[model samples]
Target: MIPSVLPTYNRADLTFVKGEGVWMTEADGRRFLDLGAGIAVNVLGHANPTLVSALTEQAQALWHVSNLYNIPQQQTLADALVAQSFADTVFFTNSGTEACELAVKMARKYWFDKGHPEKVDILGFEGSFHGRSSAGIAAAGGEKLTKGFGPLLPGFSHLTWGDIAAVNDAITDTTAAVIVEPVQGEGGIRPMEDDDLRELRHICEEAGVLLILDEVQCGVGRTGKLFAHEWAGITPDIMMVAKGIGGGFPLGAVLATQDAASGMTAGTHGSTYGGNPLACAVGNAVMNTVATPEFLSDVMRKSGLFRQKLEGLVASHPDVFEEVRGTGLMLGLKCKALNMDVVNAGYDAQVVTVPAADNVVRLLPPLNITDDEITQAVERLEQAAIQVAAQKD
Candidate 1:
């Protein structure tokens, strides 16, 4: 029988009762090594003590307050985000999609406030996923995302991924912003090269177009940096961050430079549930943990270890894995076999993995996952590969 809930997700058969670190316990008492990390949302892992404590403390004190009122937690989180990155101001939201929406509006508004109301076109790359919203779908230009959604919020131009010439041609006087993911997570963990990023930055700067980076999936310590774009030594004028920023709680933020945010005056944008005390409290905890130099260095060291192990796994199971791609913990295993076949095999091996476009299986473990857990995850992946190869044979 079909469940009462909306049939949006291709719901997996298993039900998880609880989770801790990189492990989740199924309803049937089976324990699974969780490499997917809830699609990279659980940055600090499930039920992290620090995160739990922060949430609990905030809950005990206050949960919700009107945006009209000043919230210290929200201000504190915003300040931390500003301090850690290129942004001078931060706008909180409930999810990455909201952040993306605000980013688009803010960019267009920036130009509009400057008397260039026609500069509303936003250019997005070919294989990027920017969440499921009117602006996001139109910006992504993916058939699967925009098929039935006719007359998608217009003014979005699609460009070939990593093509500097196309980008140059696309940036006309009407182009208000260029939005791209530093690492295309749902498009199969494709990391944009540093040189290409620099070129894009230069082009945007020369063209006077704002660069909006959707770091929703790759930011907040997922890439062993505070944000993935930091690896390329370039900063987007407007950046959308989510996923790990909340440490499994529902929180997102759009960050921008002071001049870039000039359009967003009082009453320009607001969110009811955004920047609530509970969410901000958790965000503070996550930022405190992830933004620390020692913590980020550990993430880099762990990423190196994970990369070496995954390369070895690919070597041992050439029939299953094509190659390993992605930066830091945001890794993907491009598959020689069907991506879903490997994912299903991972189920049998008691490991969770996420399938993406381009025949890739994503391995997004928590930043705080232990070395022992990393070794265990690799072993489980090896087992899944073996099982998949046997099925093909």
Candidate 2:
């Protein structure tokens, strides 16, 4: 039976009726450990008690109120986010893409307010994914995403990551901002060099441009920190955060310094459901639960274990895997064969993974995934690799 809605994603046959912690239960009662974590949005795991209670409580009281009026839960979450990061002001949205759009607009408006509306070109790097919105696609600079989109959104330019000369050359008087993902997610879990990120900061500073980081996928403790750019040891003038922020709820934000956000004082931007009490309530819960010294240390320990285990698996099945790379639990397998083949084979074997631009297999298990679950996932993955390796050329 064909579905009514057009499907944008590759097909996956199995559907789970319910999920808890790191496992999902299928209609047939078969349970599979969910390593994908809904592409890392379920950081705290599905049906997280805290998140459930927060959303349930809020839903019963007030699910939504127009942004036209004050929202206390929104304010509380804003205060928590600002306190945890280098931001002084925050604007809420319903998803990561919305946050990305807002960040780019805010940066350009910043320069526009300074009487440089001519500084409209936004420099983004190749393979970086901000989101699917028109502005995000324009700012990402990936040919695959922009090819069919007619009359590409003007003022967004592309530069190669780590190409100092190329990046510097791309910046001009018309440049309003430079957006980069400290850790590229859909681009195959690539982590940008810290030095290069620092150089980008200096480049933006010298060019008098704002540094806008698209942390939509890699932010909110996905990379074992509140934000991936924290590893780069510098902050962006404007930053976008969404995934993992609401503990699987739809919540996104553009956080900026007071100076960078001044242009957005009032009527500049708005979202009716962006800062709903329900989403903000859960955002507050997620922040309080996940942002902690012990939680981060656990992430470090678990990440080390994953790397060691996956590397061992790769060595054992050298024909199937090339290498395992990425930060923390956001690891990827650079495949020796087609990535989709491995992903499909894993699915057939009751395991799941995500495919990325560089033919990489990504595993974004919950941050609190236990060592036992890790061992099981690796075991299934090894079998899946063996099944793929045995295939004839």
Candidate 3:
């Protein structure tokens, strides 16, 4: 029997009623330390006060005016994004999936406007997740995402995950762009080497192919930088942003360089509910706090602290944890035991974690997680590991 809610997700039995900072209160009143941060969406943390204030004040003033007319809040957010990023223009959307759709369209339209409609192929990599949309599924080129959905969107090619040579070989005259994630979240937090990313950018430039970066999961201060690509010191011609940008509010945007966006004229693209006052207001608040050097430096310092602790954790429990992978707050523990067993044990130990591919348990705590909270989180993880070890023994 189909339940009222779709059974698409293998949801946990625990029901969270409320959240504050890095903690969530379950229906049974159990306080669980939230290390997943809603899959890196709640950057400032659950029920962040600043985000709440921004949403409430905007709710009282205005909500949705659509893209029919000019929106000040949207303009302000666009300005901020452009100022902080390599983009010269920004287009808002309701989710990362929408942003992915627009990115594909923009890339294709760019070549079309330049009198080269035949150049439509986009090169993607294995273990890359764009979104669940038609364009996204095809770009991912993964059987799991495209099994039932046939007659898939064409003009997308898949390459080896970290092979620069394959990327070089894949880009031909027909190639329109190459899309990638700086650090793969759903693909088990695999971070591309900085040198490789720089080389990818160089290759795209030489081939006259546009580079599109999918930063939806690792942007907005998640990687201890404004974006993970910053570490490589290379910029994408087109970039996708979401998740923490709105501090838990559903919001997303596609940013592009002027040349890349030239084809997207007035009627080329738009959305009804995108860039609404409510979402932008929250997004503004998030940017105000996270874009600061002090905040980002703190995030880096804490990331070092947290990673050091996780290294110790991995050492202490070789029977359960294999190693740690990732950067900044987007860390993951590859499990010697089953990743799901560790995650379930975390539930017993009052800790929350998210699971990804390659048998990894992700720890994406709030950027503002306190030093004390870091200590507590590690202790709780230790407890979970002990429980899993016990079960295994």
RMSD of each: 0.9, 1.3, 0.7
From the highest lDDT down, the ranking of the candidates is 3, 1, 2
TM-score for every candidate vs. truth? 0.99, 0.97, 0.99
In TM-score terms, candidate 2 sits at 0.97
Question: Which 10-residue span in candidate 1 carries the lowest summed lDDT?
Answer: 157-166
Better of 1 and 2 by lDDT: 1
- Over 4 Å off in model 3, which ranges? none
TM-score, candidate number 1: 0.99
Candidate 2 least-lDDT 10 residues:
1-10
Q: What does candidate 1's lDDT look like per residue over 71-147, in tens digits?
A: 99999999999999999999999999999999999999999999999999999999889889999999999999999
Candidate 3 lDDT over 209-229, as tens digits, reads: 999999999999999999999
Relative to the true structure, how large is the alpha-carbon lDDT of every model? 0.94, 0.87, 0.95
Query: Sorted by TM-score, highest first, which candidate order results?
Result: 3, 1, 2
